[model samples]
Target: MSLPKELHSSKFEQYMESIKIMYLIDDRFKMICDQYCISKIKAERNKQKSEKYLYQQLENENLSQELEEEILFYIIKNM
Candidate 1:
């Protein structure tokens, strides 16, 4: 199965096979991936706005990083 675009990363390339398995068999992993994608989009959109853009973009980026860390932890634990 094709991975979510947000999951396409050189950092994750080594774990690609495990990630694909987790994405298919793990609901929480899938949800996190979905949320990561949304957060990424929000961060991008924040670049086009003003005033609250910095705060919103930072928030989204932090969340994305946390989610990525979680994904990595999960993959490592299961591997």
Candidate 2:
């Protein structure tokens, strides 16, 4: 998703990185489990916890007001 126009370049990049990392980790776990028939409940739980922390950390940063609102909505919806 595109970030708000008001976000600083660095902050926008950081936010993208944060989201990307969560996506990477989550996708990797899902792929591994699906392909290998591995137990995934524990890994899924751990990933959820980590993603929540990442979301909170991103929210705590100097995000643009619009991006902050969007992020909050995403976090709440996911939870």
Candidate 3:
């Protein structure tokens, strides 16, 4: 599928709010986060990798179909 839509900051905020709601109701959200490597998140948070690398990781995991679309959308929106 094509890359997700371009996100504005307001859109991002709204998406995050939606995620909080989803996280409470959907086990899939938690499962996706639990599956993703913590160290990878730390690395991204610390800006240890290039944006290209971050996108690559997301794209690869995305293609693997391991994450539910909502979780992937959340991750991409945040990134």
TM-score per model over all chains? 0.55, 0.30, 0.31
**Model 3 spans > 4 angstroms off:** 1-11, 36-42, 45-79
Model 2 C-alpha lDDT per residue in residues 1-79, reported as the tens digit of each score: 3322333245447566554454456767435434433344456778999999999888867467778899999999999
Write model 3 residue lDDT over 16-68, tens digit each, in one string. Answer: 65655665677886455445545445666778567778899989987777557
Flag regions of model 2 displaced more than 4 Å: 1-39, 63-79
Each prediction's Cα lDDT score? 0.88, 0.60, 0.60
Count residue pairs with overlapping backbones in model 2: 0
Best by TM-score: 1
Q: Write the per-residue lDDT of candidate 1 for residues 1-79, one digit (tens) a residue.
A: 6788878888889998998999999999989988988998898787667647777999999999999999999999999
Ranking by TM-score: 1, 3, 2
Clashes of each: 0, 0, 0
Give the lowest summed-lDDT range of ten residues in model 1: 44-53
